[model samples]
Target chain A: MALTLETRDLTIRFGGHVAVNGVSCTFKPGELTAIVGPNGAGKTTYFNLISGQLRPTAGTIFFDGADITQLSAPLRTRAGLGRAFQLTNLFPNLSVEENVRLAVQAANGTHYDMLRPWMVRRDLIARADEILDRVALGNRRQVTATALSHGDQRKLEVALMIALEPKVFMFDEPTAGMSIDEVPVVLNLIAQLKQDASKIILLVEHKMDVVRSLADRIIVLHNGQLVADGKPAEVIASPIVQEAYLGVAPGRSAA
Target chain B: MMILSGDPPRSRVLSILLVVIILALAATPFLFPGAKAMNVAAQICIFAALVASYDLLLGYTGSVSFAHTMFYGIGSYAIAIALYSMGPVWAAVATGIAVGLPLAALLALAIGLFSLRVAAIFFAMVTLAVASAFQVLASQLSWLTGGEDGRSFQLPELLRPGTVLISKSLIGFELNGRVLTYYLVLIAAATMILCLLRVVNSPFGRVLQAIRENRFRAEALGFRTVFHLTYANCIAALVAAGAGMLNALWLRYAGPDTSLSFTIMLDILLMVVIGGMGTIYGAIIGASIFILAQNYLQALMGAASKAAADAGLPLLPGLLHPDRWLLWLGLLFIASVYFFPTGVVGRLRGAGSAKH
Candidate 1:
């Protein structure tokens, strides 16, 4: 099996503070990997490094054997790396289908035909609707993106990412603002996506239950350095991981 | 998949209405025998075209550029010089677009590169300064542009192919007279409107709309937005230059008043706003209102002056003078901004469920 995402000794410094320091990891295709830590643990910063949104102060990122540390965010996306933001970013004014169609259009390279009727293209619209259906948003296709519920907007954002048919998917706090009922739907969607053999899923999450339920492997960081990496149960059961979570358990920090 | 595709039912009606209006306008010289009325109508068509050109940038792309008149003047200068010194009217027309488009394109690229650092009023100011600088240059270079007086060119004949019979007519209208000028203007406006509609609906146009909504996200999506925006701006300038050349021919002279005037800019702006900022039909609707108001106000002011003397009342104030159409224009803008901020189309859309 080949690795979809591999970062070697990645270090990122913002001014005087080092946000991510000397972290090395390989995320394999078909694996659902979760990076979890307490607040200010730099999980998002690490994700940004791998997605090419941020340049590392040192080290390299190899995406499918190509060094992509210097590649732009969009080029990374074109190389089948997709990212979902902590805050939803979508065309708020356009219809939901129109938003999805834009992603489909991006992937298909139909960005210059002047006379072709965009919506009238049967196969493209079918593809768009299929993606929307994956996110359970088929009935709300015609509605403006701004009119949807909070949960639905999250789903729409995921649908947009899926429309790109990305090989590597990264989600940042996907369930941050969702209610209990909405959380399970998003959780299950990520789980379903992970089952595909060609897809690699990377998640930065905080909810303990969600991390254990979906992460095939778990990595923990403290103060921008990796502290633990293993199966979910092993990492969670580690004494250092327990100390990092419970805050200053006797003899752990001293050890 | 939702089977609904194509223009919604209302847009279909709008398309038909636009065709009928263009046809009626093409036939108007016969309906109204006065050359002066036809001349005014021809001028309106030119301004309407200018507004539509501006709409490509200001409306569709959401870039409110203030240097559009620079391209307008550039076109006028190119055509006037070409006609006087270099070539025939057709040659002059081509030169006008060629010179105007590349100049505007270069300027657009520069502005896009620099102006990304600032938006809204800062961008407007930068564009305004460029236009104002060009205005100053035009005034200083009296040898080429005739300064404030500007240059004059002979009106070029517009001909229909396959006939040199001089008085030959097309669809009952002569092709070699002033009436021919009107038809030419009509044809140009119709062609431009069709082309613009197609452009806005095309994939290229969708990218522009995406940039308008969110530039950062568009850039993140791998689109080189500055290049696309500059291209759009250049094309718009090319069309506006075409209109400018038509205006110079119709007027038989290109003056600072004709080319670089703030009044013309305001007229184009009003046309876009009153018609509906982002819609194609908005240009035509705004042009009609602008032309009608100017014509009607002047006539009404003349009648009022005569009537006032007859009734022995004081003369009308200069503020109310018909020549100062800007007063009414300012008021119209304020009202539009306050009441129907999206222009008349928004209200029309509101009459329905206000749903997208």
Candidate 2:
């Protein structure tokens, strides 16, 4: 498999506390990988470091065989890496199409074009509409992003990231705050996104069912260290995973 | 296909609105009946441009620096000094912009980097303090600034006719006259408005708006927010300096009392708030109200003063004094705050937009 993004000896520390330890991993192109851990397992910290939101104390990241460890978030994003926040970060006041249009603008490097009206540009608007439709948000295009239901907002967030046409995508708790019924909808979208063999996707999830359902491979993290890495079934069946999840030895039953 | 083809959507509407307004303004002097009406229209144009410059920083970027009047003062003083030295009007105007822009940029950089660390009310206070300090310095520097009494600058020639004919000379074409000054102001104001509109729609403007919405996100996106903000401030200063130069030439004088004064800040803030803080035309609406209200109130006061003297009665300052106009202005502010939180133009725009 082709490596889209690779971290080498990555470590992130906050003064006396370590959030992400020296654990290296690579996200292969055309694959969706899940990083699962209990709360405070530094999963999001690792995501932030990889996404250029946080500077790792000791680590180097490579994207598409080029070093991008020191690049800024926007630069990284422009270089074909897109991210979705655990907390929704959509532009609240703008209409759904407008939010997607900003992303499309950013990707097109036309943030400076002042003479022509954005709407008059049929090409960009069509692309924005295409991405919105892909995320099942074509119907909500005219509505302000703030007016969207929580599930619909999540879909719009995905639409924004997709609008970037990134080679690699990072989703931090995409299913957080969603109802059980809403979970399947996002799961189906994620499943569809993962089918693109040219795309690399990283997800941070706490739901074992989601991890089992969608992730091709699983990376288990505990106390900022990679505890297990293998196929989903193999990693979940590992003794270390049992110890971390059940807080006991594999053969022992917890009271 | 990409999204948002050339630039942002609202900017398109703004450009169209700007063209229509500029045409109306240029035609005002001709449309109006008399020289006095033309002069009044010219004054309206000048204040509108000034208020628009203020909005560049306050409305778009969200950096409310109270020292905007300092730039206005700098431009006034620059014109005053140049005109005193018998400088050309073009030279005075250029010098005013050159002097004002760098000073305002430096001030903006310092204020943005330092006070931004403790934003909102604290940032406002810091700006107010700097403005007050500049006001004091202006008063103390009697030699250069002409302290409280003000310094008069003589007008240079408005027109250079080979020989003066008896009949065909209008006041503006006949050399040193207020009509010529008014026309000059009208031209300057329109040009400034156009330039400012262009700058506000540029890529720099988008970055500034992004910074205003979310500083952390903008910073994370690798935008040096402070630098962008300072550049905006400098542009604002340059525009304000143009307005100031035109104003000084109109009045033919500059005074320390005129520069960095708190009352000037109050006027600009009121104009911006009344127009709509973030919208471009908000400033135009705000400035019109400000200039009109002041003129109307002063006229009313002048009539009361004449009435009191004619009746041979002790004149009450409340009815006749120009200072009492502030009471009415204060009431306008109170009413604006209570009724039209979005500003007069903004409120109207909002209502009009709601129809869609």
Candidate 3:
């Protein structure tokens, strides 16, 4: 597998606190890589740095073998990095279809057409409908994004991400606020992205079962540093990973 | 009707009403045959275009700019000075537009590029500061702008009020310069409204509305948000300059009070608020209602004051004087805001969806 995204000594600091520090990794195509850590382990911060939401204090990010360290968020998005935020970020006032349609339009490069009516773009609308149906929000296409249930908004977020046709997908806690039954639906959707042989999927998830079932490899972080990186079972059996999660040595019991 | 079949029935009805209003305005000078009525009708046309252009920024793109009137003033002065210096020819009018539009676009670009870096409220404040500075410059540049007096110059023979287009009466009114000028304003305003309608329905317009709804989401979706906003600002400035040029030609003057005054900006704000912010048709409805009220309210107040004085009530007449009509107008504005929060068009469209 070729490397699709790579980071070298990526570092970001907020005043006296170091959110992400000197973490380096390479993501390969067709790999479902799960990044897991204890609370405040800088998982989301690292995701933000890769997605261009936060600039690294000192580091270089290479996407598809090109340096994109200074690219802004939108530029990075256009450069084929798609991100679904932890909190459902959407155009709340627009309809669900409009939300996806805008993403599709952005992907199609029709966002700058100042004279033609948007409805005239049947191809974009059809693509938007297909993406909506895939995300299972076709029935509620006319509903405002804010009016959708929490689970549906998450799905809409996924729909928006998929519409971008990204080379790499970065999902920051896709199931953060989802209910129990809704979890499998999102996990299934994330799992489906593996069908594309040239795409890389990075998931930041807290659900251990989801990581165990879907991830091809597991990377663990503790205190803003990568602690373990290997197959899921191997990483899970590592003492450092066990100590980071259990807050003690593997054989020690809580008093 | 077929083109509007996809729209809600209410929108269809509103569109028809707008066409009717445009036709009514076109027939105003012929039907009334009075100079005062013709003047009022011309004002409605000019302001309808002006308010719609302002909505492109404030309503669609979600940018509040206080420098709008400054652009309008620039267009007026550009034409006035050109006509004054080069003599009244069609070429001079074209030159004025050539000079004025780019000037407005450049100013808008500079302001948008610099001030757009700030937060929304801060951007408005920056525009206010810049607009005030531009007003002072207009007042001080006496040689070009005629300073406080402003400039009035010769118009082309076809535009002059004395130039008769037809020998005989048409519909019981002579086809003279006033009528020709009225139709000129009418055609210009109507064309602008049509072009703007096309723009707001375009994909570019959707991106603007998207930016207004959630800029972060828009940018995250791969939109160059700042560029779209700056483009919108330039288009708004260009349309506003068109309206200003028509106004200067109609009035044959472009003074600080007429063109660059903040009161015109306030009037535009009030029109957008009262008519409805996001809907393009709101400009027409709002401008007509406000301008009509402004024209007649003083006369109504004067009549009441005279009636009171004739009835032997001194203090009541003073309170009812025409000079205090603004107090009444202010109250009306407050009442409109309180009652119609979303504006007249918003009310007409209903509560659930007003963005269209």
Per lDDT, the best of the predicted structures is 3
Please give the lDDT score at residue B117 for candidate 3. 59
Candidate 2 lDDT over A1-255, as tens digits, reads: 365799988999999899989989988987889998888889989988887889989989999899998987767887788888787877676678877876676677765554444455567778889888877788889898899999888887777777777888888888898878877767887898888899998999988788888899999888898889999888887889888964668976433
Q: Report the interface RMSD that candidate 3 achieves against the true structure, in angstroms.
A: 1.9
Off by over 4 Å in 1: A1-3, A246-255, B1-24, B87-89, B97-99, B106-110, B113-126, B157-175, B301-326, B353-356
The numbered model that scores best in DockQ is 3
DockQ of every predicted complex? 0.50, 0.29, 0.72
Residue B51 of model 2: what lDDT?
A: 87
lDDT of 1 by residue, A1-255 (tens): 475688899999999999999999988888888888888888889988877779999999999988998987778888888887778888887889988877787777665665655655667778999988878889999999999999899888888777877899899889888878878778878988988978899888888888888999999988899999999988887888888854656445322
* Docking outcome class, model 1: medium
Alpha-carbon local distance difference test for all models: 0.76, 0.74, 0.88
Candidate order (TM-score): 3, 1, 2
Pairs of residues clashing in candidate 1: none
DockQ of 3: 0.72
Candidate 3 per-residue C-alpha lDDT over A1-255 given as tens digits, one digit per residue, 9 for 90 to 100: 365799899999999888888999999999999999988999999999998889999989999888999999899999999999888899998999999999999998886798777788889899999999998898999999999999999999999999999999998889888899878778888878988879999999888788889999999888888888999888777788778864668865422
iRMS (Å) per candidate = 2.4, 4.3, 1.9
Q: Mind giving the per-residue lDDT tens digits that candidate 3 earns over B124-225?
A: 998899999999999998988899999998899998889978755554557888789999998998788767766777899999999999998898999988
Lowest lDDT 10-residue stretch of candidate 1 chain B: B1-10
